[model samples]
Target: MRKLYCLISLLALIAILCTGAYCQSPRTANHQPALAASNDAQRTADAREGQRILMWAGWIIGAFFVACTLYLAVERRRVVASKDAELAGKSQELLIIQEQVNQTNEELMAINANLESIVEERTLKLSKVNCELDMFLYRSSHDLRRPVTTLMGLVEVSKLGFDENTAKYLFSKINDTAVHMDTMLEKFFMINTINHESTEIGEVNFEEILDSVQHSSLVHNYAEQVQFDVVVEPGIRIVADPQLITFILKNLIDNAIVFRCKDGKRQPVIRIEVRPVGNAVGISVHDNGIGIAEANLSEIFTLFYRGSEASKGNGLGLYVVRKAIEKLNGNITVSSRLNEFTCFHITLPPSANVQIQTEAAARPVLITA
Candidate 1:
């Protein structure tokens, strides 16, 4: 635009200079008047033509400058509009990202809350276990020390030179105490194995397992007055850990024999039954025994819990049995009458797809006749 203005100014200056030169040209004193007049007129006509041409050139240049300015304005508006649209798009994207971040934070907070609840529950359980362990230690120490002390005193008395019959009675007492201590220690070892050792799962033959347990119990003095009976469903087969199952059955059966009714009106009897329940296996050990009191039923499975003076047990048998059942993802329920009978029913999942559910330690149940 500046260049166009400068060009118009230069053309005007040249026209003015030409006019002045023409006027200043020396009028020849010797020239004829008519010829000089004619030359002045021609010179004026040429100057007029040149002035018109300069004016037209200036107008054309100005029009071009106007068109260029309008073009530049339109292009600038288009560029500004494009930039505004792009900025708006970026802002929308940022808002979406912010929303997503907020949602994620809320979800994380929920998860943290749930985790805190779970941790609190676990901590309470651990505290209870610790307390139980302390009790176990005290009881174990007392029980173990009493038998040892008794044996030592008996030995010292025998050293004083007793007669034959007296010596024989002393020997018998020593043997009984020693046997009791040995049984207690064996039970402790079995508990340790249940906790640390893994058992293999296989197809178990219940008839064979039951027969073996029955024979072993009889040999071990469980047959003095009680008769054992076994009944298994025909073609009954199960997939499970054989050792664990046998241990459970043995413990229950032994408990039955140890706590049998002593009235002797009719011989005490233990009945074992195995049958299938749905997709799982069901085994029941029922015995006519001096049954558990209702008040003490729930406490039976607790470690070292003794219900009465007649309980000639270390109190680990039922506890170990419960633990074994838990390992197999099974459940046990005890139903008993005060003097009639006591029965333990166990339900076990199939070995192929056993799903272990987290459960608190087992507590026994009592049933009235």
Candidate 2:
């Protein structure tokens, strides 16, 4: 309807332009010269006037169409610009959403890495727990069961009829069995403690620790019979767990004492030496006692391993020693001569400084029997 109104208005403007052009006549420099012309010349003048009116009307219609075309082009330009702005706004929103997704992906990757680390740590702990459980089973089946069975047998024998001296002998045997069982129970507790406890490193005084072990019940009984020549470096600083080191030393020293030769040929001498070896400490525990055979050298550190058939120990001592040394990140080696002497050499990395002396007799400390 609007387009029809526009078309009608344009036609009315064209008609008005043609009427105005028809009313006005063309004028020349000569005033009445055209009136004096003949009949054919007057007709020619009238034709020229009509042609000029038609040209004027055509020019006016062309100008109106040009204006309408320019207005339509401007409106089209405005619509295109508005659509471009809307498209640009949506594109910007998409970029922002993409950045947010990338940030979320990064956070998820970090969480996955943390979870993996946690799983690895827990797996290690579980594996260690399983190994300790196996050890417990071995002890219950072998060490604990034997001593208990022997104790029960001895108690049953005590009830049998016998003379006074025989009864005394049976009582003594029963007492020894009971003591042995008690010792087994103590060792079981120690093993459990060592298994579960965490190692604590600190400054270690080898001489002080050695002195304390000598006074302890583990070796005090043989103090007079066996001489302990402790030769600790004058100022050796060792960083290790005192309990772990003490356990290792105590077992080795007790083992040396228990395996002393029965022959009364030479005095039992257990010499202990502590010195620096580069970044580690070198320890020598040598005893002049019944020695181990070459065949048992490789198996001495194993659980419940005894080098000699006549070994009175429950066989857990050396096992505990090995475990403690491993915890301290140390290594031990043994060299022995039958019926002569047995020597244990150990190297332990202590996280501290050591005072090394080139001279062997700088400050010699000797304890003789």
Candidate 3:
């Protein structure tokens, strides 16, 4: 492209030089006869006419060059205008992109704010649920006392079959049993209203809790004939809720006695043990009277589930037990064989920092988020 421009400039310079040389050429001067001079004058007039023609030709050529330069200038201006229009279009597109980005940022901020609001709302809902659960526990505890008192009276009346001396001992045991039930009911309510912030954890004597449960159940006539053999290590102190722990042990012992099969041929036997497992305490209740079927195992702790043609219960006892264990942040597992044996292993944390295990396949873990 540079070479083309240089060639065009060189051609214009050559044309100008040729035109100057033609304009500068001098005319000839010499002596002449009258007729010759006249002829010379005519020749001179003809040469002058030729020079005027050349001058006109030069003007026409100069005009042509001017016209070409103007054409080139107009074309260059058009090119510049087209480039400016293209740049303006690109600038408009960039503005649109910037506006879109700003709008997207605003929307994102709005979404983030909504997410925060949802979190705050959920926290308040959880607080409300905890409050309601505490209220339910108080109501249930108040309601349970009426029926339990009547049951204690009935047990007293049932003692008529025995002698007076035996009756007196039985009444003492019965009264103690009622006291124990009352205590367990109090613990049951505590379990239902468990809060990490509200619970007090200290040295819990597991052996004593178990002994009280056994003695209490005997007073209630639930374990009159069955001999309980507990093999728990004495002086074993676990950091847990004493009331809730006692309630858990009571329910387990009660369930063992209640689910005993009337295998007309054999007597009821139940074995209980509390042992340590990898820094955690495991309390197991084993019964030889009656065992549950595998199919009914998973359904045992559902809200009001019951086994078919097997045992009878209020259906909430085990559910309450499960909730109590959860209050302690512990785990419970059960394995049973029909008409043979059943074992329940309750594993508790050594202290307050117990890992709570979820057992949806076994029983529901009752806890708040």
Clashing pairs in 2: none
Candidate 1 local accuracy as lDDT?
Answer: 0.78
lDDT of 3 by residue, 1-369 (tens): 345556666776677677657655665654555566676676777678768867776786677667767867787889889999999999999999999999999999999999999999999978866775676566556556755776677577775577788777766766755665665565455445654335666557755776677677332575556767767554344666677777677777777777776665677777777666666778888888678889888888654456755543445567667877877778899998887989989888654644322212433222110
What's the best-to-worst order under lDDT?
A: 1, 2, 3
Predicted candidate 3, C-alpha RMSD: 10.6
Candidate 2 lDDT over 1-369, as tens digits, reads 348448956795878666666545464534465665654475576667666766766676667666666666777688888888988999998989999999999989998989998999899979876885687687668877887788788778877778999888988887777777876676676677678887776667776788888986658878888878888775566667887778878888988998987678898889988877776779889999999888888888776666786688777887888777777777898999888999999888653322223334467555543
Give all TM-scores, in the order shown.
0.68, 0.60, 0.48
TM-score of 2: 0.60
Which consecutive 10 residues in model 2 have the weakest lDDT in total?
351-360
Off by over 4 Å in 2: 1-136, 161-163, 352-361
Candidate 3's C-alpha runs over 4 A off are: 1-191, 194-198, 217-224, 232-238, 261-267, 276-281, 308-312, 328-330, 347-369
Superposed Cα deviation of residue 260, candidate 2 (Å): 1.4
Scored by lDDT, the top model is: 1
